[model samples]
Target: MDIPQVISKQAAETGEMGQEYLATGKQVSMRRWEQAASEFGETHCREYETVGMLISGILELDLDGQTATLGAGDSWLVPEGAPHRYRIVEAVVAIEATSPPARFNNRDEPTSGEA
Candidate 1:
């Protein structure tokens, strides 16, 4: 049997924030979002690890209080439960790979004053 397949934004799980996995067991998902400078605040994932590559533009990342600016061709590993935040200095396209698959979804729209 063939595994399930989906395009980045066409998938049912995709939205303004991002996309997540529906079926469990080893899975992979990729998405791209264009962000403006200082448009988003910090985010942290407590359930899964993520590995990602910057496809284009520049990103400023704050990993547990340490800061780094990543550009195209750069990649990093984010362990579960680590607090992190990122903003795009220029329009950016990021490709992310998650392990154990991301089973959650952000269904609610962003609240006022929230990122």
Candidate 2:
């Protein structure tokens, strides 16, 4: 079995995915987006599947034309290769977990063009 690890908020790896902080393991990864307000109109189709929760503030998620408004205590999922986009209705602090390690081999990077 693997050893236990602890990562504090200040110790998270930062500077990817627009100032988000990340804690990554072999099979999965978690990222914290604090007060993020950029990329509101850009749509992206990621290579990894993600499950996320809004810790605070408001967000609008558009998944392949269907839209949902997310507030504190809300959670969401985006399947791999699913085209999606986010609009920040308010400054957002959120946490997301990705399978297959989204940061591995630059999987977290945005695709070449809009989805």
Candidate 3:
């Protein structure tokens, strides 16, 4: 995918945390999450796969019935359609790459504040 170089794109506050996203065609996406403490109360099953590297703070993810606590120096992989939930142990920042582009999947359509 010929990903464009993001020069001055702004971040959109979509979730409890803020997010900046760059979609590369309909194949992949690059995303960054801002530092914010939050917990996804309900479980979610994502239809897209994701691989991410934690940048700062801490996060605890509950996948199926297992919980993994990730610190700043950790990398993670989540397969498609996995039931999971996450809580920010502290404010967190992460860089993630997703396949089956989230925008195309219609996962969280742009909200009023979304860019």
Q: Which numbered prediction scores highest in lDDT against the true structure?
A: 2
lDDT tens readout by residue for model 1, 1-115: 7776544444545555653333344454444555556654846544567788888999988788888899999998878667777878888877776664654353224433345
Candidate 2 lDDT by residue in tens digits, 9-100: 77767755564556678889888887666446777888889999999999999998899999999999999988888898899988999998
Position 29, candidate 3: lDDT: 76
Model 2 misplacement above 4 A: 36-39
Residue pairs in candidate 1 whose N, alpha carbon or C atoms collide under 3 angstroms: none
Which regions of candidate 1 are displaced past 4 Å?
A: 1-13, 16-27, 103-115
Better of 1 and 2 by lDDT: 2
TM-score of each: 0.69, 0.88, 0.77
Which of 2 and 3 is ahead in TM-score? 2
Residue 12 shift from truth in candidate 1, angstroms:
7.1
User: Residue 92 in model 3: shift from native, Å?
Assistant: 0.4
Better-scoring candidate (lDDT), 2 or 3? 2
Q: Count the backbone clashes (under 3 Å) in each candidate.
A: 0, 0, 0
Clashing pairs in 2: none
Please list all clashing residue pairs in model 3, or write none if there are none: none
